[model samples]
Structure formats: structure tokens, C-alpha cells
Target: MKLDLTIPSLGPCHVDSPLKLSKQKGISTFNYSDDTQKILYDTSLKNFEACLAKGEAPLAFEKAGPREKIYFDPSKTKAAIVTCGGLCPGINNVIRGLVMGLYYRYGVNNTIGIKYGYEGFIPSFGHPFVELTPRNVADIHKSGGTILGSSRGKQNVSEVVDTLDRHNINILFAIGGDGTLRGVQAIVEEIERRGLKIAVAGIPKTIDNDINFIEKSFGFETAFTTANPIIRDAHNEAKGAYNGIAIVKLMGRDSGFIAVNAALSMPDVNFVIIPEMDFELEGENGLLAAIQRRLAKTKHALVVVAEGAGQFLFNNELGTDASGNIKYHDIGIFLKDKIVEHFKKQNMPATVKYIDPSYIIRSAPANASDSVFCGKLALNAVHGAMAGKTGFVVGRWNNQFIHLPIPVAVKERMKIDLQGELWWNVLEATGQPMEMKS
Candidate 1:
């Protein structure tokens, strides 16, 4: 095939010195260095053609139904509760509620407690069980530590499943924080792999109050309730004793929940410092300046700070145990020491009083709201399982006890609904600052 070629873009007569035109044989081919057409795309049938094709008897089944049905056995009703991580105050209340709900209300008699958390549930460690009954948990609502006790951290998923199978407990309730919930996920996945059926539910119970899905965990209410009176009484004492400032630090890692609550309880509080807020700690002169300013106007002022507030204290926080766990020391003590040190340095005339409320907050008796929340959360977990619902953490949303799915909660990060602006407004009205310094 003989063909004539034209370089249309460039002028025919004008050529660069380095350019050359070569002539070929009669069977002329535009012999480029490389030639390959890799793709020849195609389109699917149109409406008419597709309609003409057979619509019925298209055969393929990707999967079949399960060989064995996993229906709940009414006669085989059993439950196991495990508490992992540090002991939160309302562990007993949740356990008590679960037992009571399962036995008296639902007639589930064979409830056993998984002793010492998921760590003890491992086959490597001998499986320890607690025989649960209404009588056993009679006064547990007022109790502190888990009656079954608890261990910290997690175990392998297979190990958890093996332990679950060993105990033959159909329903497992995990009581702790985020770590405990993650462990539950692992165990659930493994149980699915084994084709075994078990209902896994997580009850939020962290002093940190960082877990998602649950807006408020069981013990946090108790903690605040326990701290409320001390805050009131402490503020009163500090006010009566001196015309100076008294700082009370509560436990909260970064969230202002605890400090915010304490500050609300003592509205005359001078300043509230939580990790979520600003992280600046000042000397006595600044605090004293504010206190004296308030005292000049009013009497004495109280301040609430979070436990995780680092370096805001005069005394170094106490170290943890041999296991390398950090024990939260008194935030109040830190404030008190700083105030005392500031007074010594400035030689101020006002009597400075420093009091740590860490011990008092932990020892706080269970409050009405907290006890109710804890009990409700336990019942929610059980019923949620009986209904075969999962990934939801029990909480009070819109003044009703409900399940907040973990997927939805994680995407939202268990945060305060700033968009609503109502909670924030109420907080500000209660004398809780969104941010506080020193």
C-alpha cells in the first residue's frame, strides 16, 4: 500500500537541520519505533438488546444459609460478666442490676461471673467463675469494687473464645473502658470464625469517661454525686477559714466532665482547669490576685481542676505501682500546695488553705442518678443482646435509656453536641467556662 505523507502542522518546505525524511518501498508503512494497541474497549447491551436477552433462569448462588440455627435456648439462659481495667466505683451496681434483671425479672438462674476480667478467662490461666444470684448481689448497689473483682488489659481473641467456650457461658458482658470493648470485638470475630454463637455486650465503666457510644458511663455519675457534697462542704470550709482561694482538682484526663461538674456544684468557684480547656498553671500571685479580687467583691472563691492537669500542682504527683500503671494523685492536693507555696513566697496576709479532693471524690457514696444510670445500662446490655442487637453502648439520650451503636458513636467520637449549643449554654450558666487558665 503506497501512501503519501504530509507533515501538516509544520510547513512542508521548512525543516530543522537535524530533521530528515526517509523514503520507503511500495508496501509503505509508517514504521514508528514501537507499535502495540493494548486495549479494545467494548460497551454493554442497550435497553432494547438487554430486554431481548433472557431475564429468567440466570443461575448462581454465592452463599447458602447457615447449617445450624443460633436461636436462644430459653432453658439454657446463662450470663457471664467480666470487668477489665482499673476499678470504677459502679462495677458492683452494674453487676447487681444484671443479676437482678436476669434472675427475678427474666428467670435466668445460671448466671456466672468471669473472675478478674478477660485476662482470667484465658485457658492459660485457670478459668475462675462466680456463681451469681440475687442474694449474692443484695447490697452490691452500695458496693464499690466488682464482687467478681477485675483485671487490667486484654488477652488474645482465640484465648477469649476458648475461655468463653470452656465456661459455656452463652452471654458475656464486659464492664470497663475502650480497651474492654475492643477485646469484646476481637472475641466476637473469633466466635464467628468458629461458627459458635455468643452474645457480647460492653457496659461503659471508665473514670476517664473517654469511651464512645456511651455519653455517660455507670461510675461517672457516682463519682460526681460522691464529689458534689465534698465540693460543697470543702468550698464552705475554705470560705469560712480564710479569705483566700481554694483549688479543688477532680479526675478527668482531657475532658472537662468531672471538673465541669464540680465547678457547677460550687458555682462560686474562681476558675476551672481541665485538659480540654487551656493548660496553663500560674503562681499564687495570679491566683491570689483573682481570689483577693473576688474576696474584695465577695468572701472566698473555690477553683476546680481536672486530675490530668499536669504541672499545675506544687507537689509532684505520686507514682504508680510495680506494674507501671500511673495512679492518679490528688488534683486538689496539688492546688492546695500551690496556693500555700504562693502565700509563702508572696508573704500574703490572707490565710491560704489547700485541700486535695482526690480521696473524697473516689470515696463518694453512690448518687441517685448514678445508681439508676448504672442499673439501666446493665439492663440495656442484656436486653440488647436478647434482641440480638449489637455495637450499641447503653446510655440516656433525650431522657430515655437506649442503645447508641458503636459505629455511629465512633464516627462522632462520643463528643458533646456543640451544634445543639444548649448543653454548652446550660454549662456556662452553671458557671462552667469552656476554657480556663490557672
Candidate 2:
């Protein structure tokens, strides 16, 4: 894994040991640090050639905001905060953190909380605005749901723009998941269309950890840790009865981070199902067959399934929610029914138990790790917004707060890398087969 920078026809282009090279033709090349260059030099020739053909360096995340003046003057700045989408563990912590950051760090006391997401900003809805202060947000971090409340459904763009203008908000911080970020993107576009200089920043808030490129999303740790006891209960329940199978379904609409991580957290899980991988209910290595095999080895078995798993077996006429995300068929119930039916067909006595703890897991308060992460996300979002960095979501990348553009954040949903270490570790821990037939 080495690279020789000598050009074929031009002989050796003389340069310093450390040099900045830009592509001669295109403007798509990326700036590489000295360390990045060294890494590139140590890479394989095939990969190095591929990197050159792409006309960009190996991915690099730059800091957000411009090199010019800041966007807001503390004395004259007014900020707005809103929460959207489903409940997660750290929503309240984020609200309290943002309020404290604005009030104490920047001395901006004119922060307004928009209730019920974008709907609250519409004039028809009374344009509900709650003036926030340190005193009011003191104990909010100890709560679970957002103090500002939340809702789904997209609001009128023009009306939202009008409301922001009427409120004279200098910056806005949106706390939610991908759908919420898209909504924020619309608001920012409208503000730009109106020639307003208001800055918008998003705080990634998906408990599923499905937002692409974000190393970690707030509340995932809290949700995963909180779900451990539930999984243990399922495991214990399986052991209580003879020939018992317990299937516990966790949350993960599009991705299976929660299901996979919960399997990792609770090692007693005999089988784990996720949306990323496919498995069948019958046939040689299918799920039902696999459960029978496990039961042959042990009297009881515990299974963990993501809510979004085994969706291909369901009806084609699937539904969607307000965010336009496809509604997932219940994998837990489907697994339970199939297991029971298989046992009955074999003339074997068995008890199948299904537990869905989605609501209970998502509604819990933030744990220590998530509370700290939520605070960092909030502080960074506010700092980025105040610095005129708009149209970006503040997320932790490489263990640092980075301003990821909204478009990039929502471009693709992050799923478990089936071939990656995390999945491999899950396999090692659960002793599950890599593939279950087709």
C-alpha cells in the first residue's frame, strides 16, 4: 500500500515534502491535510487510482460557517426553537440546553419557543410563542417530552416565513429527525427567497440513529440502555416455560440500530432480526426452522426483532405516516404467530410471547451519555446559527461537533453496515448465523 506521485510523461514534478495539489481541470478536488496525504500515500494503488478518478480527496469534513462577521449581535438578536417528530429520550435536555446556551453564553434573553412544531407558527394557530428564560427552563432537563411540545405534518411555507418575519427572529434552531430537517430546509429557503438573513441550524434527534453520516445521534444510547431490562425480561420469560420462545420487537422504522444494539447490550438473545438483513419463516435455514433448531439444543429461545424487519412478507398496500415514511408491518406479531404455528404443525408444545416496548423505550428520560450529547448538540447548533451558518445540522462527527449540511444529512438514511464490525460483533455475541437461507 504505497503510491508514487511521479507523473508518467512529466517525469518527477518537484515539490516540497508536504504539498497542496489541486486537480488541473476540475474544481471538485478536496483539500487534504498532511496526515490525509500520508494516509493516501500508504493506500493501495487501485484505491489511490479510484480516488484520483473521483476528482475528490478521501472524504473530509470541514468546519461550518463563513470567515466573515457573525450573524447575530447579542443585544439585538432574537432566536426561535421548535421540536418536531416522535418523542425521544433527550428532547427536553436539548430544549433546556439551548435555552441556557442562548441566555448565559450569548446573553440573548429574547428566545421564543414555538409549540407543536411548524403548525404552531401558523397565524391560524395563534402563532404560539413562549418567551424562554433560565428560570423557566431550570428543571426541564429532568423531563422526557419536549417542553415546547411537538407534532407531525408539514406546515404552510409562506405562512411560516411570515411568522418568522413577524417575530423578528434572528436565528432558529430545529430539533428533530430527517423529516424535521427537511422542514427546516424549506423554511431556510423561504427566508433566503425573502432576502432575510436569518440563520437556521438543526440538532439531529433520531432515536433510531438512522441519519446518514452522523457518527452518533442524540438519545440512541439512552434508548438502547433503557431497553436492556426489557430484553432481559424477555429472556427470563423464555426460560420460565418449557419450549418457550420470546420475541421482543424494538423501534427502528427504517434502520435497525436499536434492535442490533440491544442485541449487543443483552447477550442472552438467541436470534436478532433487523431491517438490513432478510430471513425467511420456513425452509432449511429459515427463521422458523432456525428457532426449531435452537429449541432442539435448548428448551427455550429468546429473539429480538426490529419493528421494520420482515416487511417483504407483508401486504403490498403499505401505509405511510405524516412524514411520508412507509408504515412498517409488525414483525414481532408475525414472528410470534409463525413460531406458534410451526410448533403446532410439528405436534410440539410451545409458548410464544411477543413484547413491543417502542413507546416505553422512546418516552424515557435521557441517560448520562445522551444528556451530555444533547447538550453539545444544542450548544453547537446555537453557536453555528449565531455565526451565520445556516442550512446545516450540528452533529458529532469523529467525536467532534460538526456542521453537516441539511441536504447531506437527509440524503440517505444510515443503516447498519451488514459487513461492518458492528454487525460482526453482534454475530459474535449472539452466535447467530450470518445468513438464514434467502
Q: Which structure among the candidates has the greatest lDDT?
A: 2
lDDT accuracy of residue 330 in candidate 2: 76
| Candidate lDDT values, in order | 0.59, 0.80
| Residue-level error in angstroms, candidate 1, position 333 | 4.3
Q: What lDDT is reached at residue 145 by model 1?
A: 70
C-alpha RMSD for every candidate? 22.1, 9.0
Q: Model 2 off-target regions past 4 Å?
A: 1-57, 64-69
For residue 274, give model 1's deviation from the true position in Å. Answer: 1.3
Listed in order, each prediction's TM-score against the native is: 0.71, 0.87
Cα lDDT tens digits, model 2, 219-335, are: 999999988999999999999999988989999977999988888899999898999998788898888888888888898999998888889888675678988888777778887
Estimate the TM-score for candidate 1: 0.71
Candidate 1 per-residue lDDT, tens place, 265-384, comes to 556565666554334346333444555556666566677767765544436656764224456655566666665775577665555555566655654545777787777777766655
Residue pairs with colliding backbones in model 2 are none
